[model samples]
Target: MYKKVALAIAFSPTIEALISETKRLVELFGSELILIHIGKKTDELETQLEEIIIKTGLDILNTKLIWKEGKPVHMILEACAEEKADLLIIGALKREGILTYYLGSVGRKLIRKSKCSILTLIDPRVEAERFSKVVVNGTQMEITPKVISKALKFCQIENVSQVHILNEIKLYAFRMATASKGSEDEVSNTRRKLIQDEIVYVQDILKDLDKTGLKINIKITAGKWAVELVRYCEAFKADLLILGDERGYTFIDRLFPHDLEDVLSELPCNLLIIK
Candidate 1:
């Protein structure tokens, strides 16, 4: 049922693994694969890409190859919007340079701002997580029935049990009282406001999801959004983590770092990012 997917391949060592995983995903979901190669303009690389395609037997008609002369993240976002892709697949190479990868430098940029769901391949040797034991993370109220239905289909295919819903809400309190003065009332009021807002937000989301017949475990948490989400995945022994990515070009995303450190770094399980 997942028809359109945009795959951002670095054309590095992960290409072979990516192709193999693509085959598995297509077989499982019956979706179209748009393979994109991001690198400096070079005909040799293109030829190499083709050779790999032939070698891997990823010669399907639905597969596409794009050679763009720009930053990888920007070109990827453009492609997603143009193709109306439902998902984005990229490779995460874990190396010694952690700090450089952070601070909005490389692939992390796309991870933060991608409009469609993102599936990051952690190890070239490993592909595909459990079809069952899936975890869903997002605002419950915003999740559509169609999305839930699709998720259910995946669960059924994988024979999964226990879908955990993650709710993330943070609270902050402060006032500029000469940088030294603090008011107890101000702190108390801020706490009260945070609690009230969280209650309202969660209530609305829960009401909508209640309509779905799927049984799920509700997990309410506060603090950093992506970190806690990954933690829950680890604790529950979830095989897959599902998230919803918004579509289209987002100006704000480029300005900030992608907040999926735990999900990418501590990839104890596979990730399924859906739009």
Candidate 2:
């Protein structure tokens, strides 16, 4: 559960869904909610936001509404940072174009830029569902522990019975680059040992989770990351997927402005990205 939640609101279809999900999360974590709207502040927009708050059933908590004038992405990120939000919830929609792998939508940008965790709902209409099973990626070995630690906090609150860990080593990149240093057999052994070592390391790091009494399974595969993850999650009916960002961003770019669009399409459930 998060301590503070920052919700970026725009006049879009995802607003209602975002608010609805926000209400559920607020109820779950008893967390403070900060509502941010970036646009020309107007009486009409205030009335609309008020109505939205009422509709969201946020009357139970003293929620704060902030109106600022600036670019949407800039204002949203600023508000989240100012509030020290542990969890930032936003929506993602595909843009109209040739559909490049890098879909630099505001949500994707926020996921990349924000230092905290983010929950992205690609579809506005999908209702907020309780998480029963969680799938967390461990490919970013350095950040895997933190990601799983946060996921375990949710599991403790949500009573998640199972967690699926995916550590996908990019075989395509490996064949081209990793083979440069070692013989065929050496490379094969190294690849096999990588997964074997990860299993032992992750299990050791997550020993505390075992006390929670949830069934945990970690598997390392060599293949396409996005394709295999989508296939595995769909088969298992994952309620939420958590991933970590490990790459260093060098610019005013919204988190990995290049690779996100290709990696994330529509998911069977929600996505939580921890930076």
Candidate 3:
């Protein structure tokens, strides 16, 4: 269970929504909520923040309001470390459009860099109106189901709509017996065995999720793994991109270790990484 939840408030139009959603998360986990506001300092701004909190009827217990002056993402990160928050929640806003975009969002940045698990609410109303719909990539490991389940529970009280499981399969063709070539049959057999191993791994993960009520959609594709996964999400219109991190597994760090900050800067949608 989470011990503390940090809500990064930029005083945008979505602050109230962020607070409401943070309240839901706080009530769910029974965790402390730290409100972080970052921008140029002014005497009136702090007073205004307090007014907003009081007017919203937000509970003050286990809730903190911090005023900092600096870059939004940098200041938020500093506060997160200072508060030692277990999870960070932020709003994802669309740029000049009604639909939400994940790129260049403070939520996305914190999701990547914060050393704790991250939760993103697209908007308070959006979160209120519908449950989370997740799309996950990189299912070669055996521990994905457990991580996904925990994240789904954290996202909403209800189960997610569809969980997309994506795997990358790379195929290589061998040339005929030439000066630098080996036996075709031998190489083919080796490739087949490796492919079989990957298939078995995927099957094991699926079996672990057999009784889960969440809708499951599986895909095995061949290409640059990350690019393909991103494309798949765009094509399917997935709501959340649930990727794995260092939480439930031991060997994740050695295997394609992810930098959340870089991913947040690039992904077009919100990312939920199990750290």
Native-to-model Cα distance after best TM-score fit, residue 17 in candidate 3, in Å: 2.3
For 1-275, candidate 2 gives per-residue lDDT tens digits of 68899888888767877898888887899999998888888888878878877877777348988788887778888888888888888766655574312224666667767877888765545366777788877664566787788777777777778888887765665576565777888888767766677677778768876437567788777765556676677788887888777655333234444334445655555788887
lDDT of 3 by residue, 26-131 (tens): 7767888799878775778777777766766667754688888887888888898999987887776665654435545555556656787776665465144344
Question: On residues 30-97, what C-alpha lDDT tens digit does candidate 1 reach at each position?
Answer: 78888876668587887887787777777556577666668778988898888888778776666566
Candidate models: Cα lDDT each: 0.64, 0.73, 0.65
Q: How far is candidate 2 from the true structure (C-alpha RMSD, Å)?
A: 4.5
Backbone clashes in candidate 3 total: 1
- Ranking by lDDT, best first? 2, 3, 1
Off by over 4 Å in 3: 40-43, 54-57, 70-74, 97-102, 105-109, 121-127, 141-146, 152-157, 171-199, 206-212, 246-268
TM accuracy, model 1? 0.66
TM-score of each: 0.66, 0.80, 0.70
Off by over 4 Å in 2: 94-104, 124-127, 169-194, 210-213, 247-259, 265-268
Residue 213's lDDT within candidate 2 is 59
Name the lDDT value of residue 29 in candidate 3.
71
Query: Which pairs of residues have clashing backbones in candidate 1?
Result: 115-246, 117-273, 131-158, 132-160, 141-205
RMSD of 1: 6.4
Worst 10 residues of 2 by lDDT: 249-258
Residue 169 in candidate 3, Cα distance off native in Å: 1.2
